[model samples]
Target chain A: MFHNDGFHALDRQECLRLLAKVPVGRVVYTRQALPAVLPVNFSLDTDSSVLLRTPASSDLVRAIDGAVVAFEADDFDAVARSGWSVVVTGRATVVTDPAEHERLSRTGPRSWVVTGEGVFVRIESEMVTGREITVPHSTD
Target chain B: MFHNDGFHALDRQECLRLLAKVPVGRVVYTRQALPAVLPVNFSLDTDSSVLLRTPASSDLVRAIDGAVVAFEADDFDAVARSGWSVVVTGRATVVTDPAEHERLSRTGPRSWVVTGEGVFVRIESEMVTGREITVPHSTD
Candidate 1:
């Protein structure tokens, strides 16, 4: 990994690739003005939208829709002292149109919760960015 | 794990225990009024406060002092369909007291970032809560 400035700045493609590689991410949302982060098992749609399934009646389901939120995923090598983290800031919209619902159902993610329900929310990336750190070498 | 009032509520002691077990966590802070979650390697202090090391000039270190932030960590068993996530909402304070600083240096977390600096911030938990889901025996 090469550093663009001080930290490695990942391009759009690499960011999407990393997002697809990790099934679990934490979604940060503001509810009643307090920031809350929830772990979600999500999928990356072909169009590069982050898709997640939650129950229709859940508060998370209601809070994320039309709200600006962030989804983050990372994999770290603790022993090597390196890792990559990607954060996407976006606005979420629930799939309510029948055609979109059918299409998403065929490609959207499944929930990790035991009694998982089938309410799908798609977060369209408004700003996608990432940073990565590599194991330090003596010569560098 | 069993659920109380439809959510698995973890007690204070159990929450701190789990916090110590996990070396990595995500710290959620508001940056320019938007919520951002950054992965952090943290340590639990004897007083049950969460501590981490970041550079003095870093935005996180500067913004978090006296601000409310959330520290989250979790362990999940995918195939078993069970896991617990703990969220600690607290106020962050920079370690400035010399005697306390010396004591913390012996116990505070070390940074994972290459060329790690030693600016310490302690997050005192005001509210601790967790949720867990168990395996489903019935096929849906």
Candidate 2:
């Protein structure tokens, strides 16, 4: 029953549920002086952050390492007439620990970039927010 | 028709085409010794560049005002069992001209963030790359 003008605060369970449903999302960060947004494949971390895979040679790796970032995911079906979106904003860390990397790498995405490519970055969200879109039910 | 190890060099037209079909993507930036990635709605400009509307108050705006950035878009269809992705690396500029903003704003998108939100940020690409997921296609 969320309205357009009012933000429906999301609880932990709702946030997790939304994240599980959407596979692709946007990651926003600053490169030089303007905002840059990129499409990424991510898995939800056990701690509730977004885990993304990238190549070491990737510009995304270079530009976003050790920076503040935002990660979002959503789904819409015009025919079904329903959709939802979730956003996770926080600081990102490059996972260098072999054991941790190995664990994440097992479940992380295979870079759509290239073969022998690897997931070099990981982001842990500090704050999460979400909302949904639905046709207003008519009482008539 | 291009492949390098794993990276695919996608021309401008290919990037624009794929970008148009996808609705969610991520933005990456660096701030305070960490990397940040956020999801956002975006469009391909007439110049075939990536443009995003964001809140002026957002940290994304503060990071990209005069910085280097990168953008990405991708499409995935489980039914067709096919997908393609485009990545743009470049510098970002905030569009201030009313006419330009208004014109670009007309394209399709329903930003979850507030309007009067912030100025629009556009990325002027220097390098673009793309790839298609093919079960039979091998990089080796």
Best by TM-score: 1
lDDT of 1 by residue, B1-140 (tens): 22421346778878888888877899898888787888888888877888887766677876678898888898776566567789898898888888887886676776775354367899888888777664452343
TM-score of 1: 0.89
List, residue by residue over B15-85, the lDDT tens digit for candidate 2: 77777787666555565544455446676677766788766666677877677666666677644435777
- What is the TM-score of each predicted model, taking all chains together? 0.89, 0.61
Cα lDDT tens digits for candidate 2, A1-140:
22442234566678779888766677777756655666666778777778887666677777778887877776755344346667778777888888888887677655544456465576676877776554442221
Residues A1-140, model 1: lDDT tens digits: 22422357888899988888876888899867776888878898878888987777778877889888999888876666678889999898888898888887676775665364467898888888888875472221
Worst 10 residues of 2 chain B by lDDT: B1-10
* DockQ of predicted candidate 1: 0.40
Clashes of each: 0, 47
CA RMSD of all predictions: 3.4, 6.1
Model 1: colliding residue pairs: none
State the weakest 10-residue window (summed lDDT) of model 2 chain A.
A1-10
